[model samples]
Structures are given as structure tokens and as C-alpha cells.
Target: MDVEALNALMRSEFSQVANDFIVQSVAPMEAVVRMPVAEEHLRPGGTISGPTMFALADVSMYLVVLAMIGPVTLAVTTNCSIDFMRKPTAGVDLIASARIHKLGRSLAVGDVLIHSEGMDAPVARASLTYAIPPRST
Candidate 1:
């Protein structure tokens, strides 16, 4: 799926979380997702929360795989390892760049680097695996 198709699916099928993200771009084995830092996503320290970052990382990879395999809503994350590095820039949108290293019939694996908007170094990095449901065939 491309950006528009994925965004439309998000709005139609997953409206609950659709407004929080933007399917910015997709290319071969790669995708970029954007999440604007909102008041609700912040902690008491004015920093983006861990769960919020994890969500971005997870969803970013999910979109990347979807870009390759079409809209597979049943695909689920089976494993994720994330490390929070630097503090994210407050009030800045976060950008997650995901790259698919391996894609298989039943699984897809990738790594994601999340950076605060305009920053060079990533604030967090994640490696994830998704369990793609069997095709009807």
C-alpha cells in the first residue's frame, strides 16, 4: 500500500488511533511515519512517554510491512526490542524511519530509528518482528 491507501485504511478501519499518525512515505523495504507530540502523549516531565515511542516504533514497522504486502490487518507484532536513548525534543513531532530487513511468508522483521523532528541522532531504536496471518489461498 502507498501513503494515501494506508492513511485511508487507518481512518476507516482504525479510526481510534488514526488521527495520531501520518503515513508520510513508503519505498522499497522502507517507510516513514510521523507522530506529532501532543499533550496527551507527554509525561509529567514534558517528555514523550515510553509507551508512546513504542507505539510509534511498532506502528511504523507495521505500516512498512503493509506497504509491501498490502493491508493485512491481522498481522501482529510478535517480538519487539526497543532502547530509549536521548530525550526527545519537547513539542516536536517524532519521525520513525523503518527498514524491513527480512520479509517471509509468515513473518517480517525490521529495525526502526526514531528521531525528534530535525534532529540527526535517533532518540530511540527498535527491532521488531511481525506475525503475518496465513493467506486464504
Candidate 2:
């Protein structure tokens, strides 16, 4: 799948929050995604919320999978586990780098690292498993 095509799919299919996440680059089994942190993404401590970071990781891996397997809307997150690391820097963007380790006929597994822009250490890491849709007759 193509990067531009993947982005367009995001725009058309997920217009609700599509603009929030950008598909920076996508390759065979990897993708870089970015989210321009807004006030809505911040929490009581004025830092990025855990849910926001998790969303970044989720979408990052989802886009990577889509880049590899096409826009399979039926593909769903069957399982996900995320670890919140250091607190993210305030007032900048968040980036997620995801790499897919396995892509089988029924499942896909990948990991994502989230970084607060300008920070050296990762803010969060996530492991995601998705269930690919079976082909219909």
C-alpha cells in the first residue's frame, strides 16, 4: 500500500479525528505517526494524557498494518497492552514509531514507541494485536 493512499483512507474513513494524527511515513511493515498535541490532549498535570498516548500507539500500529494489508476496515484491535513510561513534554507534538513483527492470515502483531517531541526518552510503548478479516466468498 502507498503512504498517500493510506493517508487518504484515514481522511475519508476516519474524518472525525483524522486530522489529529498524521501518517508521516509508511513502508512495508512500519509507519511513523504524529499527533499535534492540543489542549484536549492534556490532563490535570498539564501533560499529555495516557489515553492520548495510547491512541497514538494504537493508530500508529493500525496504520502500519493498513499500509501492509490495504484498508481492511474489518481489521480490529483484538488485544492491546500499553506501558506508560516517562511523562511527555508539554506543549509540543507526540510521535509514534511502529513496526510490525508478524502479519498472518488472521492476526497481526506489532509494537509502538511514543515520544514527546524534543524529549530523548520514550513516553510510552504499546504492543498491539489485531484480528484481520477473513476474505468473504
Candidate 3:
């Protein structure tokens, strides 16, 4: 779908707080989400935390699926597995590149690779499955 429609749907379905969690660089098949490193997102080693990365992965997958299927607010995550690979740089933005691996009638699967801004390797990787709502006649 178009950017305007996608932005409209995001504003309607998700709260402004959630919307502020990540910016939508693109919709559906691919998206780039940014998460700013902040005190609340830091861990013991002064590195960005895991939960913050997980949130990025989750929202990235949601946007990819929604891009393919339109704004399905009922679409819910059925499964998710994330692997944290490296410590993220402090005071940097994290970018998640998410794409759909499969899109079926009842489910959608997505893979995400997250990296710290300017980092060469991924800091984390995630695979997610979402249950898509049935289409109305």
C-alpha cells in the first residue's frame, strides 16, 4: 500500500506511544526502524538492552506483515525467537531491517537483522510468526 494509507492505519491502530517507538521508513515487505539509545534502554555494561532490541524486532515484523496485508490491527504475534549476538554501541540508533519470509492466509513469517548505526555486523537477529486475521466477505 501507499505511504499515506500506511501512516493513517498506524495512527489509528497503534497508540502514539507505540508509534513513537519506531519510525516507519518503509512499509510491508521491507522497513527500517530506528531505536534511540537512552538511559532507560541501557544495560549493566552501558550497552543497549535486550528488551529494547526485542521491541525493535517485534515492531519491524509487525510493519512488514501489515505492509503486505494492509493494516490488520488484529494481527498478533504467535511466535518469536531472538538471538542477541553482540553488544550494541552506546548513544547510537539501532536499525532493524525486516522482511517477510512467507505470507499465508492465516499466518505471516518475518526475519529481522538489527544493527547499530554504522556497525558492519548485526547485533541481533530474530524470526517471528504472526497470526493474520481472516478476511471478511
Candidate 4:
């Protein structure tokens, strides 16, 4: 697949509507996504919320799927499991490194490791599955 075309598609379809997430960089099989930590993204522990991390994982995997399959607007997440390993710093940016593990006609799977900027270990790990739409051509 054309990586540039896929990136463009992601920007067009998701970037405009994803207020908290940003596509920092994109490659053929990998992508780096960032989410700014905000007060609204915090839970009772005064750290980033689980839902916020889940959103990051979701978007990161979505970008990875798009990178491999081009821009399929109908590509949807069928399953997602995330493990939160640590608390995220409130003011730091959360970065997710997403890589596609399998890409097929009907489905795509990827894993994302999310970390706070400057952190050595990941704060969360997520495995995601997305249903890819059929290609027209």
C-alpha cells in the first residue's frame, strides 16, 4: 500500500475530528500518536484516566491499520484490550507507538505501547483488532 496516501487519508478522516489525539508520524507499518494530558482526562487518582488511554490506543491502532490498508473509512475496531501499568504524569504528553501485527483482507490487528514523554517504560499496552472494509478495486 502507498504509505503517503494512507497517511493523507488518516489526516482527512480522523485528524480533523479527533480533538485529543494527533498523528505525530506515520510509516508503512508503524505510527506514533500523541495525546495531550488534560484535567478532563484524569481519574480519581489524579492521573490520566483509563478511558483516555483507551482512546489513545484506539486511535494508534486505527492509524496502523490505515497505514497498511490505505484509507478505509469503514474500518472499525472489533476488539480492544488494554493494560495500564503505571500512572501517567498529568502535564506530560502521552505517546503511543503502534505497530501492525497482522494485516489481512477482512481484519487487521495491532499492538500499541503507550508511555509518558521521557518515560523509559510504557504506562500501558493495548492489543486492538479492526475490521477492514472490502477494497473497491
TM-score, one value per model: 0.98, 0.96, 0.88, 0.87
Score residue 70 of candidate 1 by CA lDDT.
Answer: 92
- Candidate with maximal lDDT: 1
Reference-based lDDT, each prediction:
0.95, 0.90, 0.82, 0.83
Candidate 2, run of 10 with poorest lDDT: 1-10
TM-score of 1: 0.98
| Candidate 1 vs 3: which has more lDDT | 1
Model 4 per-residue lDDT at 88? 84
Supply candidate 3's per-residue lDDT for 108: 89
Tens-digit lDDT string for candidate 1 (23-60): 99999999999998899899988899999999999999
Q: Give a tens-digit lDDT track for model 2, residues 1-137.
A: 67788779888999999989998888779999999999999999889999899888888888898889888987889999999988898789998999999999999999999998888899899999999999777
Superposed by TM-score, candidate 1 places the C-alpha of residue 131 at a distance from the truth, in angstroms, of: 0.5
lDDT of 4 by residue, 16-134 (tens): 64557777777777988888887788878679888889988998898778767666778999999999998888879999999988888898888999999999999999999999888
Checking candidate 3 for backbone clashes, the offending pairs are 28-67
The better-scoring model by lDDT among 1 and 4 is 1
